[model samples]
Target: MSDRKPINDAMDHMNGIEGYPTNVDLKSLPKPLRYFGYFFISFFVLFFITFFVLSMIL
Candidate 1:
């Protein structure tokens, strides 16, 4: 039973598509500004959600 389990798991992984995009493509932006751009966008989204919730509660 244990030996059959390993073969089943290996086959499952091999059956899927490989080499997919798993991270952000930072090189498309200017080097020094990429971090700031990501940070600014994330902060704006978080701030908007917080403000929206506060407004609804008050």
Candidate 2:
């Protein structure tokens, strides 16, 4: 019968987490550079995990 979803309740639950940094200024960067940073960090994490696994296996 209600049209509005319970999004506020879910967000309130997330906000209660310990040590969670709530104030992120994503708009400070250009759109392209933001995506580039995401891609670079993702690649770095993946490469580190793969190298660690391979080293353990060999």
Candidate 3:
């Protein structure tokens, strides 16, 4: 029974998707890539403010 248990457990976890990764390790990315989240938020806020101010002036 022990021999079949491992095989059955693996089958149950399978989602049947093809050519896609099952997991990701973000820590493997470089330092700059990890800090992209902060830069993205800052850029979004700055763009929104600039657009709002321009519209108000016009």
Candidate 4:
């Protein structure tokens, strides 16, 4: 019994057409996760804007 990987492993790198194999597909997430991601991003942006405006006004 051999523990070594086959030579076909080298051909697997062709799957990444974007030139980067580590790219993350955020759109493929589930429904709840998409909502959570949108909420989190909007929350941070709104929070930053509110604080910035308050600081300028005060």
Find the candidate with the highest lDDT and give its number: 2
Clashing residue pairs, candidate 4? none
Model 3, 1-58: lDDT tens digits are 1223324645645633332343568787788987897799899999999999999999
**Pairs in steric clash, model 3:** none
User: Model 3, poorest ten-residue lDDT window?
Assistant: 1-10
Over all chains combined, what TM-score does candidate 3 have? 0.44
Ranking by TM-score: 4, 2, 1, 3
Number of clashes found in candidate 2: 0
Task: Return the candidate ranking by lDDT, descending.
Answer: 2, 4, 1, 3
lDDT per residue, candidate 1, 1-58, as tens digits? 1223325765646644352344557687786698898889999999999999999999
lDDT per residue (tens digit) for residues 1-58 in model 2: 2233446976656655532544569878898999999999999999999999999999
**lDDT winner between candidates 1 and 4:** 4
Model 2 CA deviation exceeding 4 Å by range: 1-26
lDDT of 4 by residue, 1-58 (tens): 2333345755444433324324568888899999998999999999999999999999
**lDDT of every predicted structure (CA atoms):** 0.71, 0.76, 0.69, 0.72
Relative to the true structure, candidate 2 has a C-alpha RMSD (angstroms) of: 8.2
Q: TM-score per candidate, in order?
A: 0.46, 0.53, 0.44, 0.58
Clashes of 4: 0
Question: Where does the lowest 10-residue lDDT sum fall in candidate 1?
Answer: 1-10
